[model samples]
Target: MKIKDFPHAGETPPFGAGGSGVGLYIHIPFCKQACHYCDFHFSTSLKKKNELVDALCQEMILRKDEIPGPLQTIYFGGGTPSLLEAEELAQIFKTIDSHFEVNPDAEITLEANPDDLTEAKLKMLAASRINRLSIGVQSFFEEDLKLMNRAHNAIEAVTCLELAKNYFDNISIDLIYGMPDMSDARWQENLDKTLALDIPHISSYALTVEPNTALQKFIEKGVVKPVDDAVAQGHFEILIERMQQAGFENYEFSNFGKPGYYSQNNTAYWTGKSYLGIGPSAHSYDGETRSWNVNSNPKYIKAIQSGELPIERETLSVTDKYNEYVMTGLRTIWGISLIKIEESFGLKFKEYALQQAQKHIEEHLLFLDQDRIVVTQKGKFLSDGLASDLFLINLS
Candidate 1:
């Protein structure tokens, strides 16, 4: 079949035609060690790295027909995509180039760790097609680094950013806030250091202890103090104020970016654009259905090598789509469109949404802007809960 003649042709508007375009997410499931708060799919052992890389390339070939046209964004996310050798990245990129037509201005990003980004490595990446870098510099303090067990030290975080700035222009760094012992002053210092570095984009989040993770176990055993939501909320408020003062847009709940520096890959996802995800535990969506590959590395490699895809699929219900739209839209700067809800899902759903949102609006947590419902600055942190209250449980 011709690449442009895919099954869902014309189902959605093409990005080049002024709408959001398709994206590709390649998951690399290898890390030197696991972080205490992380629950994402990954393994510490690099024994199967070669086999996994081969599987990733093969999976791309198998799913190349799934994309409608040229890719607008390509993201290498994971346990540490920076761990891949230059040659490995080349081989993968060669396969992508051969099978797909990438846009000349495509936003190709690679998620890296601070320790892996040496001067040599930065130079190597600058020479490649990766135009953006998302470095995992979770914290800038030595105690926080030790508590989280991050591979890089505080100095490495600063040094890598200094070196990386000389090579790449579009750079983003991750920061975590609201740890047990984190004071308001400490959080402010973190923001201060980020601004001093002149980073273009920042993705920060409150530290949450996930079930079965080391953090959870520690909290349970009293070895580590339990996380306090009040502290997290305070940190979040500080973050918003600081970033605003620094001329950064709180584009999404957890992301802040300078003008023209927003993450295209992430924006597409929040706006409900389709994307093709490759590699083990990666997810793929094509407007209607959502599918994910097997999370087990050995199983994934074996399946791909045998010319089979180890995936599971689910077709979203109308209510499911509406709920998702409300959830994502509320968290973003682009407010939920009452017109879109009614036009796409029917007048009943739109009316239901407004009726549900009325209470919050009266409380000064929400407001109507012409034909859309937007969260107030006071409501931004509670977007998820507010969105849930507007969900239609019986519409499906």
Candidate 2:
């Protein structure tokens, strides 16, 4: 289907009005070990962990006023935040409290690796204001864990869940599908075991062969089979059908949550809400333009210590804004709303979007529920391609 040809006549809007309230993403780039498929900026060494934490706290303190609202959502993502000592994390939180305006009921989340989870640590995290724990339990199968070089085994993954559940009521588990050797039956078994836990949220993602990763190298050498698109599609279908049948709403392409359990932090991003990202390799978006820190941890530390921002930024164009909304919205239950397209971009773009979306609707690849143009079940996997097709040209 052809998308409407809309012109950005003028450039897109800048990020914020004196930095209106923004979500915070604090990246922790240290880990016990690096997974074969992981390309995210992280290191396995603990030598500089404490120093990095101090730097991060300082970074937050320096950038506090840049965010206008008391922090609504604080997400600790990356190099295995669960690896930090609970007290260390608490120190960082205290620093944030000192400089920033954090709401009393802020939805604080920590990304945890299964092997790093412990009963004591869970207690410490709970005692702090961290209300949610998103565990990295990539797969429930022992073979899958070994293939991915995960530090935690199947038993450890399962045990971590049980332990985490005892302390944190708001728990989300991350699972992977369509791995090189992950069979359809095994995938189903993983789903069954996950459903048994009855987690409040589930983030399931299909394995992709990203560049420069060990998985990509393995495929090049024939050490591991290349990813099977057919197999991935099959598993995704199972994921959607099973999760929906289990009463889990497909909130995002890779996320499922029970009623009232959607991830507010992530939702903010999808809905064009402003957010601040701190630490090495983190990216921050403020409704319009986006900025990111240097990927090198040592470099980030050096820059911050010199009293500099330690980042590079890009201004958003009208095309960039429109395309971002299309890309993110199509991946969620909200889809793309004509009203939002109009309000955010302008009325001219809105009229063009609705006119263009009619083609996809007729092709049965998209659903038109009044003002909302949503992707159909068959179109979910092709969401990226479809969104790209509808993008406004000349982003630069």
Q: What lDDT tens digits, residue by residue, belong to model 2 across residues 1-396?
A: 323211111212212112234689999998888788899999888888888998899888888877867777889999899888867987997898788887666778999988878788887888877899999999988889988889999998999999998898888999999888788899999999999988989999888889999989999999989999889989999999999889887767898888777787877777678888999999988766789999998999888888888888999988788989998888776688887788878887787777777787787777776577777777888888777767777522
Least lDDT summed over 10 consecutive residues: which range in candidate 2?
5-14
Scored by TM-score, the top model is 1
Those runs of model 2 whose alpha carbons end farther than 4 Å from true positions after fitting are 1-21
Measured by TM-score, how close is model 2 to the native structure?
0.92
* Model 1 residue 252 distance off true place after TM-score fit, in angstroms: 0.5
Candidate 1 ranges beyond 4 A from true positions: 1-20
Model 2's alpha-carbon lDDT is: 0.82
Instruction: For model 2, state the Cα shift of residue 340 in Å.
Output: 2.3
- Tens-place lDDT digits, model 1, residues 1-396: 222312222132123224345899999999999999999999999999999999999999999999987899999999899999999999999999999989888999999999999999999999999999999998899999988989999999999999999999999999999998999999999999999999999999999998899999999999899999999999999999999899897777898989778888877887788899999999999878899999999999999999999999999888888998999878777668888888888888998999999999899777676677777778888999999999988774
